[model samples]
Target chain A: AQRVTQVQPTGSSQWGEEVTLDCSYETSEYFYRIFWYRQLFSGEMVFLIYQPSFDTQNQRSGRYSVVFQKSFKSISLVISASQPEDSGTYFCALSELGTNTGKLTFGDGTVLTVKP
Target chain B: NAGVIQTPRHKVTGKGQEATLWCEPISGHSAVFWYRQTIVQGLEFLTYFRNQAPIDDSGMPKERFSAQMPNQSHSTLKIQSTQPQDSAVYLCASSLDITGSQNTLYFGAGTRLSVL
Candidate 1:
């Protein structure tokens, strides 16, 4: 069984500031991937970033980056220079490589509110 | 590419009625996944298919819930005798393939189901 946990239910940040959302997972599989997704107010979910368990390097895409700590089985998504449009629900998901189903176990999500 | 397409962005049903959701995966994608999301339960994996074949459905309810992917293009998830507790946003996602280290999933806007 794989489980993802997002300790912060809600987070608020000012424009141009950095916001970090934490995520932790528990899985028996040695190989898996962690993903970050943002659900806009329009109800569409967009992919933000992803980090593989095998890779020790932290992944960064635009203003979105991930702090992957394999030894602690934890990952964090950092949004730099946040803007008002960045306000949305951020979900952390896990996919186990052992299962061919490609099903993702997602966290409860952290709702972010960026104020101008 | 239009990404993954989910029809009936919103649906309302009476108790004991049936609700069916549809999804069209990416053209060359081989894996499709279904998930349900709510404010309380967050995101829950329902089922998935690989190359039009039923794979793991461990997350689906044993009764009253069913899913099928008859071809590589489309899939459907049907819930019989829908209950109020079943009300949630159903999300569909697709991936090129489940193998390899990086399996990034593309998601649709999702269908919001409401049972009264």
Candidate 2:
């Protein structure tokens, strides 16, 4: 069994400031991938970024980046220069490699509110 | 592309009634996945299919839930005897393939299901 945890239920940040959402996972599999997604108020889910278990490099995309701590089995999504439009629920997900199953176990998510 | 398309953006069902959700994956995407989202559980993987074949359904409820993909383009998730607890946002996603570390999923604007 695998589980993902996001302790922060809500987060708030000022415009242009950086906001970090924490995530941790427990999995016995040696290979897996972690993903970040944002759900808009319209109910659409937008992909943000991902980090593979084997790659030690942290992934960054535009205003979004990931701090992957493999030793502690934890990861965090950092949103730089946050804007009001960045307000939404951000989810962290995990996918096991070689499972041939496209199933993703997701965290409870952190609702982010960015003040303009 | 239009990305993954889920039908009936909103639905209201009476107790014991049946609810069926539809999904149309992006063209050329070989993998499709279904997930249920709620405030308490976050995103729960319901099932997945690859190349029109049922690949994994371990996350689906054994009795009242079922899913099928008759072709490569579309899939369906059916919930029998819908209950109030079943109310949630059901999401559909698709990816080109489910291999290695590059399998990124594109999601649809989820269907919001409400049981009365």
Candidate 3:
């Protein structure tokens, strides 16, 4: 079985503040991938980040970056310079490739609110 | 890209009713995914497909949940004997199939289901 965990259920920060969302996963396969998505109040699910394995290059999109740790089975998303528009739910995910199927398993999201 | 498209932005049903959610992946995408989201449970993976084939459905509830992708372009998730606990936002996502390790998912706005 594969599992992903996001410990923080809610987080809030003022404008220009920085925040971090935590994630952890358990899988038997050594190779893994991580994903981060944002869901707003309107119920739109948006793609934010995708990281493949411990050796895969870290992905950066403006203010978002994730650190991948293979030994501890953990990953974290760091959001810098938060804005009101960034208020939403953030999700962490894990996936592994196989001969049979490919599926991404997700964690309970962290709800983030950025105050203006 | 139009990204992933899910129909019936919202639906309301009574207990024991049947509900079907649809998803159309990006034009050339070969992988599709389904998920359920609620305030209490957050995001939960339901099932996914690769190249129009049922991949892993370990996340789906055995009693009432079923998913299918008969063609490469679209997939459907059907829930029979729906319960109040089934009320949540259903999200559909798609990705390329080069390798499960290189998967980058594009998501839809999601179908918000409310049970009365």
Off by over 4 Å in 3: A98-100, B98-101
After superposing candidate 1 on the true structure, give the runs of residues whose Cα lies further than 4 Å from its correct spot: none
- Model 2 misplaced regions, further than 4 Å: none
Best-fitting candidate, scored by DockQ: 2
Model 2 agreement with the true structure over A1-116: per-residue lDDT tens digits: 88999999999999999999999999898889999999999999999999999999999999899999999999999999999999999999988885656578899888999999
For candidate 3, the TM-score is 0.89
Give the C-alpha interface root-mean-square deviation per candidate. 1.1, 1.0, 2.3
TM-score of each: 0.96, 0.96, 0.89
Worst 10 residues of 3 chain B by lDDT: B95-104
* Model 3 C-alpha lDDT per residue in residues A13-72, reported as the tens digit of each score: 999998888999988876667889898888887888877775656677889998777778
* Fnat of every candidate, listed in order: 0.74, 0.82, 0.62
| Model 1, TM vs. native | 0.96
User: Weakest 10 consecutive residues, lDDT, candidate 2 chain A?
Assistant: A96-105
Estimate the overall C-alpha local distance difference test score of candidate 2.
0.92
For all candidates, what are the clash counts?
Answer: 0, 0, 0
**Which whole-number lDDT from 0 to 100 does residue A54 have in model 3?**
55
